[model samples]
Target: MIEYVPVIESPCMSLCVMDEASGWCLGCGRTLDEIARWGQTDQADRDAVMAALPARMERLEGKAL
Candidate 1:
């Protein structure tokens, strides 16, 4: 019997800088809690976090502009 493991990709860009104001990673747009729990989270949870990343990144970029 073989045990199957789900392989979910990480959003890390190798630039692990955290934005103090938003508490989000500057590169991946994931919160510290989210980043920490990512490997343990299910697909649905990971998807939810990925879905929110674009907006989070947008907001962060807007602040820089």
Candidate 2:
């Protein structure tokens, strides 16, 4: 029998711009280290990062206003 493993997709928006002040990617809201280790990270860890993105983006947007 084969075991099923789910794939955790990356959140890259192709913007690839890093905000020097926060150290987060403007497009995906991921830190440099998070982006670097994404492929090697497990599902739970990836999910945790994904969970944090919305708030990060919201904060970034708030800063823009």
Candidate 3:
């Protein structure tokens, strides 16, 4: 029997612009470290980060999360 694992989708929007003031990517609102480590993270961790993205983007864009 084979065990199957789900793949986590990257948050990249392909904008790839870095916001120097916030140190986060303008497209995905992820820090360089987060982008770097995302591929190696497990599903639970990826989910946690995904859950937080909306709030982070809202804050970065000066909107309510």
lDDT, candidates in the order shown: 0.94, 0.92, 0.84
How many collisions between residues are there in candidate 2? 0
Per-residue lDDT for 1-65 in model 1, tens only?
A: 99997777999998999999999999999999999999998889999999999999999999999
Give the poorly placed runs of model 1, Cα more than 4 Å off.
1-5
Question: lDDT-based ranking, best first?
Answer: 1, 2, 3
As a whole number from 0 to 100, the lDDT of residue 1 in candidate 2 is: 100
Candidate that would win on lDDT = 1
Q: What's the TM-score of each model vs. the native?
A: 0.88, 0.85, 0.76
Please count the clashing residue pairs in each candidate, in the order shown. 0, 0, 0
Number of clashing residue pairs, candidate 3? 0
The reply for model 2, stretches above 4 Å from the true place, is 1-7
Error (Å) of candidate 3 at residue 46 is: 0.7
lDDT of 3 by residue, 1-65 (tens): 99997766999999988878888788898988889899897779888888988987887788323
Candidate 2: clashing pairs of residues: none
- The TM-score-based order of candidates, best leading, equals 1, 2, 3
